[model samples]
Target: MQKILVAGPTFPDVIERLKQYFEVDWNQGNALSGAELTQRLADKDGALTAGELINAAVLAAAPRLRVVSNMAVGFNNFDMGAFNAVNVLGTNTPDVLNESVADFGWALMMAAARRVVESEHWLRAGEWQKFQYDAFLGADIHGSTLGIVGMGRIGQALARRARGFNMRVVYHNRSRVAPQIEAELNAEYVSKEALLRIADHVVLVLPYTRENHHTIGAAELALMKSGATLTNIARGGIVDDAALAEALRAKRIGAAALDVFEGEPRVHPDLLAVPNVVLTPHIASATEATRRAMANLAADNLMAGLGEGPQAGHPPNPINPDVLGKARRS
Candidate 1:
């Protein structure tokens, strides 16, 4: 049988499914270092990974690696140029987790606007001796302008939710979404700077890319309303963590909530010291059902990319379909 590596912790059921077609090597513990990942892929025909870096060096070592299926919607960890050079198919699970992620983004925005985390921490620390009218004052979510940085699926979902709160929605995207979509969501297209200046709440849902790094930085923060809340459910590095930390420390913005960070699993020390910011380990698409769907979709991509499943040679979500026509190493 052709061999494959499940390069990160995943559902056991997903592993069982992969084992039906390939010799499966599964890693269920800590994330592997770059060298270890390269070493393991040395003999594999395909891989199913969650954020494992597959760069030029690793591809050079993995002579037989024909495909890599990433379990999340974002494949920023992938070195697409390397994959293309070697005709390695790359796929990601998308669409399945959109609603779940949108839900979390909305929650994060609300939590930040309402000072939910700050108040909870204060109560837990026995700092709430008496209720004061001015205590834990936070920005209002209702009847305010909501600015979304990316008007993609999750961003549209967020815009739809804004209607219930009677909010006016404005979004800045790489390009404008269709007019019907804008009408349906009651959203207005705006410049990033305009959105930052006028919004009472801002949520980021854009994908991460080299050009998109630090989409929100010191200057962007300075443009925001002093009473506005900022929330990020997008990939880390989309916001400059250091700059955000400084803004929060200076009360430049009302509060901030982050679900992703730069150099994550290791948050910035300044952010930790600030009491107004809310931080969560990246878990936006973490609902049980959504996660399972993502895992199964990834498995489908892996199987199809490896020519082992019903959709053999036609993975549903190929990041680089041109590779399908090229000679695969496997």
Candidate 2:
């Protein structure tokens, strides 16, 4: 039997299903460190992985390693260049997560802009005095200029949320969306500079890539309107956390919310110091129903990529389809 590995704690049912088809080596903890992870893959022909660092070095170590089906939507943890070089396959669960994450993104934006978390903490501290006239004054989401750093499915979902609020949507992408799309969403295609400069609120939904590291750095942050609100439901490292902390400290932007962070699950200490920022542990797609859907979809990817399901030979989200050649449609 071909050897398969589950590289992290995943749903038990999913593991049992993979066991029916492949020799299963289960790692029941969270992701292993880089060295230990590579060691474990030494015998795995394929893996159902969540957040393990699988790069050229590991691929070189595991000559038998063929497919890696990641349990999450972001595959930035995989070294695509290395996977492509070795003709190894990688896949992620995507569309199944769009709405859940988008909903959370909107929630974070509201929470940050309206001082929801800060005020809650204050109230919890037993400091609920009589309602002050200007206590925790916050920016209004309705009729604000909403800027989106990415215009993918999740980003578009967030734009749709703005519809009831009558917010104008502006976006910056690698390339522009079609005019029809813009018209349909009541959105405008803007340069990154323009998007940063004018919008009252900014949201990030972009993928992480080498080219996109710190896409919103000091310079980008400088362009944002003062007292604006910012939210990130995208991957860590897209925005410079240190710079963001500085901006938050100076009240350069009124507030910020982040569900992802640089080098997480270690959130930046500076972010913790700022009460104006809302922080969450990368749980944008963490609703119970949605999380189960994501897990099942990830299992489906692992099953298909390993040649065991209805999709047996047709894994749906191959990052490098060319790498899988005969393995794909066989």
Candidate 3:
């Protein structure tokens, strides 16, 4: 039987499915460290990961690793160049989590705007001695500008949510969405500068790439309205955490909500010091149904990648499709 290293926690069904075709040494609770990940991949023919920073060095250590399937939609975690060089098939779960993540993004935005977490903490501390007017006063979302960076499916979904609030939606992207799509969502394409300058609430939903590092930095932050709220549902490194913390301290941006961070699980110390910012531990797609779907789709990708299943000879959404012809031949 083909050997697969299940390097991260996954649903029970996924574990069972892999066991049907491969011997799975499942790590149900903890994913592997980079050093441990490389050592474990040394003998395995396949791996199912969840954005574990599997890079070229990791790939070089895993000569036998033919395929890698991450349980999440974003493959920025993988080093595509290395995978292509080594002819390793890489697949990701997409579409299943877009709406769920978009919903969470909107919630985070609302929480930041309304000072939800701050108020909750205050109430918990028994600070509600008297009902005071203008306490925890916040910016209004209704009739305000909603600016989105990296306008993908989730970004568009977020735009649809704004219509009900009577908000104007503007976005910045590498390529503008087709005019029809813009009309459908009632969104306008704007320059990054324009979006930052005019948006009352800015949301980020782009992918993570080297070129995209610090897409929102000091310069971009300076352009936003002083009292504007900021929300990031995208991957880490897209925003400068230190810069964000400083901006919050200076009241440069009214408030901010972040679901992902630069060095996650080890957030910037500065962010924890701010009162106007809301932080979450990267749970935008953490809903039970959505996470289960991500796990199952990852299993499907792995099974298909191993030259089995209905998708034999054609894995869904290969990041490096060039490897398929080579993998099949090998």
Candidate 4:
């Protein structure tokens, strides 16, 4: 039987399913260090990871590795160029977590715009004597111009939710989405600068790429309305966290919320010190059902990518499909 390394903690059911076809080496403790990951993969034929880095060095050490199944929609953890060079397939769980992530994006936006976290902190400190007329005043979500960066599936889902709030949706993407999709969602295409300048609330849903690094930086933040809110549900490093922290401290923009951070698990101290920001530990798709679906899909990818399971030889969400027929193993 082919040996598989299940990196990071995952549902037991996913492990059991994989055990049906492969010898499983499950890591249920804290995240493994780089050396440990490389050592473990030395004897493995494939791996199912949840954000562990699988770069060229790791890939080089794992000569037997043919496939890597990422549990999340964002496979920024995988070094695509190396995977392609070595004919190693990488797959990610996409649509399964779209709605859940969209819902969380809304949560973050609302929390930031309404000063939810800030006010709650104050109230908990026994600072609420009486409700002042202007206490915790915040921007309105209804009748607002909502700007979305990267109008993909999750972005469309956000636009759909905007309808109920009576928000006007404008999005900026690498390329405009289909006209029919825009019409269906009543969304308008705009330039990134235009979106930043005019939007009452800006939500980022773009994937992370070399060109997209720090897509929102000091200059972009300065373009936003002083009272506008910013929310990011996308990958980390897409926004300059330090710049955002400075902006928040200066109140350059009204408020900001982040689900992912640059060099995360280690947020900028400035951001933590600021009171106008709401931060979550990258759990935009943490709903039990959605996470389970993601895990199952990842398992499916690992099985099929290795030429096993019901969908033998056909992984559903291959990141580099060109490497399919040329995989090193199988």
Name the candidate, 1 or 3, with the larger TM-score value: 1
lDDT of 3: 0.89
Whole-model Cα lDDT per candidate? 0.93, 0.88, 0.89, 0.95
Cα-based TM-score, every candidate: 0.98, 0.96, 0.97, 0.99
lDDT per residue as tens, model 4, 239-310: 999999999999999999999999989999999999999999999999999999999999999999999999
User: 2 or 3: which has the higher lDDT?
Assistant: 3
Ranking by TM-score: 4, 1, 3, 2
Q: Please give the distance, in angstroms, between residue 190's alpha carbon in candidate 1 and its true position after superposition.
A: 0.8
Candidate 1 local lDDT, residue 28: 87
lDDT of 1 by residue, 252-297 (tens): 9989999999999899999999989889999999999999999999
RMSD in Å for candidate 2, one decimal?
2.1
Q: Higher-TM-score candidate among 2 and 3?
A: 3
Ranking of candidates on lDDT, top first:
4, 1, 3, 2
* Candidate 3 lDDT tens digits, 177-265: 99999999999999999999999999999989999999999998999999999999998999999999999999999999999999787
TM-score of 3: 0.97
Candidate 2 lDDT over 164-269, as tens digits, reads 9999999999998888888889989999999999899999999999999999988988988888988999989999999999999998889999999999999889
Whole-model alpha-carbon lDDT for candidate 2: 0.88
